[model samples]
Target: MNKAKKMLFSYSFLAPSIILTAVLGLYPIAWAMRYMFYDYKGYGQEKFIGFDNFRQIAEDGLFWDSVKTTFIYAGGKVLVSLPLALLLAVVLNRGLRGRNVLRAIYFMPTIISSAVMAVVFFTIFNSYNGILNQFLMKYHLISKSIDWLGPDHALFTVIIVAVWGAVGNYMLLFLAGLQNIPDDIYESASLDGAGKVQQFWYITIPMLGPVLQIIIMLAIINALKGYESIMVMTGGGPVGKTEVMYLYVYKLFFPTAADAGGAVQQIGYGSAVGFVTALIVGAVTMVYFFFSRRMSRTF
Candidate 1:
């Protein structure tokens, strides 16, 4: 083929992906952007009410409550899972038997469907007649069955489930970063009588700094954006206790029979909420980047 023809052929290979992205991803975002300022229900005229939707959002106590719950859930998941994942990666990076098998076992959850995972956890954590309650009763661990999915504990329970699903993915990331570090650095440190903990703190951590930052950023984003499992498990909960930002946005767009004695959708308001939620996630990412820069300079 001639050079121009060859170039055209190469571009043709990317045509489908470009078209699909424009249709599915780009189009929806553009639509939402246009709708955020309007006051259109699903089956009405496209009324452009300007910043009224944003104003409504500011006054929406439930939306702000959802934001608070989101931060709590995201904070709990990242704080608990990242350290656990790092510890697991460090141990498994050693010359342990069946480490590969163990890695696969840990990563299995990442591949599971969020809906299926939530269902399984729901069975285990049901307020009454759950497997966990049964086992606890059998072991006499508590005088009464614990309500894992109750309003009081729903947020905490969702955090635990989120951590469980996320740890494996972060562990693999940590493992990859750990593997990239040269063994010679550790060997030289060992020769100088640096113990394993000292080598880890001084050498491994420093070497893995760039990868660690990326992993942390991903974790924060994932924690903030994730709501599928929570949606399925509690549908934003017994009383919005487990409702996060994304889940709240979902409910606003697709309010179900469970909401407020049969709810209706709010497409315009939901679009506004979605846009604000994206901004919140973006703001968080910027803050992390800011701190990471300072941290890199400090070390």
Candidate 2:
């Protein structure tokens, strides 16, 4: 083909993706940015009131509380999931029988839709009639069924579900990192009198540093953004106990019928909140990057 036709052909291939991204990704963000300075419901005439939406964010205690709850949820999920994922990666990386099947079983949860996974967990953790309750009751483990999804326990319950779904993904990443390490390094460590745990601590961990940094960063962002299971399982409450920032923003734009009339859609305010929430997540990622850079220097 001639140069012009070849160039045209390349541009043609890129055009569809560019158009889709502009429509699906860029347009919504631009729309939200425009509306953030306005006072509008989804159906109302928009009234521009610059910075008012942001000012309101400062005084919104509920949003702040949800931010705090989000930190807790994110922290708990990361703390539990990363170590377990690494451990699973280490174990499964070994030369063991049926390791492929085991890895597949562990990974199955990652393939499930978050909403569908949450629904399954809902059935299992249902306080009154759940299979968990039935099993515990039959064994006389407790005098009565514990409320797994109540206000006090709801956050914890969702974290467990989040970890269960997330660990598999991190494990697979860890497995890939592990496989890239040379077997010769382990053999040398073994000859030098290093035990399995010693090798893991002194060799595997140090070697996995770069990938670990990336994994932890990804895990933190995912945990902070995770709200699907919380929304599905609790709808952000028996008492708003499990309300993360994203879920809170979701309700602002799309309140459930159960919300008080005051909780109706405020598209402008929702946009502002969404912007702030994105900033919060972005700030966190930046902080992690900062620390990771310092740690990388030390190594």
Candidate 3:
């Protein structure tokens, strides 16, 4: 076979995946971009309105609220989960008995579906007759059952659930990174009178920089893109207190009406919200990358 025919055969093999990606991924992105320039409803007619949708989005208070909520949710999840994961990884790396079993137990949550987890948490966080409240009451932690899904407590509940769902994955990441560090380094540090803290600070942390960077990046992206859990747990409800950007976008597209009660038929505005969200996520990711790179250099 000649070079051209070989190339053709290679291209033929690649065609299906390329075509599928274009159809599923690229097509919607392009369609969303196109719709962003228009006053397109969920269906029927679409009228081009230039930057009107963008302007409205800019002026929308709800959009800004969602943005704030998204940042808070993302920041809280990352801050809480990463350190906890690292700590757990370090503990597990100490070669304790049943460490593998404990790691599996921790990681099991990550493999479970987010929706399923949401349902489980939903039951756990039930304001009345909930296990958490019952435990609190039994232990004298609280005199009465607290409303976990109330307006004030809703976001906090979601954050706790988010952390629980996320920690296992990052723990596994850190565990793998921990294993990759040379045992000789730790032994040398120990010989030099370096304590556990010193060994971790001077050796382990430095070696884990690359893995830490990747984990942090993924955590930030996951936090920013969070939707399913919030949707299933709170439905972005209790007066939109837990309404992150994704759920806000979902609601914009499928607003509850007087008759339908919970209907979202505004695809264009949702697309516009999605576009804005993409921009925010991209900017945040860039900032994270910049800081991570700088930190890596420092180490």
Estimate every model's Cα lDDT from 0 to 1: 0.93, 0.93, 0.89
What is candidate 3's local distance difference test score? 0.89
Put down candidate 3 lDDT per residue, 201-264, tens digits, no spaces. Answer: 9898899999999999999999999989999888887887888998888777767762122564
What would the TM-scores of all predictions be? 0.96, 0.96, 0.96
Error of 1 at 249 (Å): 0.8
For residue 73, model 1's alpha carbon misses the true position, in angstroms, by 0.3
The regions of model 1 sitting more than 4 angstroms off are 1-7
**Which residue pairs clash within candidate 2?**
none
- Give the range of the ten consecutive residues with the poorest summed lDDT in model 1: 256-265
Global Cα lDDT for candidate 2: 0.93
lDDT digits (tens) for residues 125-181 of candidate 1: 998999999999998987788999998898889999999999999999999999999
Q: In candidate 2, what are the lDDT values of residues 232-275, reduced to their tens digit?
A: 99988887788899998888889867853465788899999999
Of the two candidates 1 and 3, the one with more favorable lDDT, higher being better, is 1
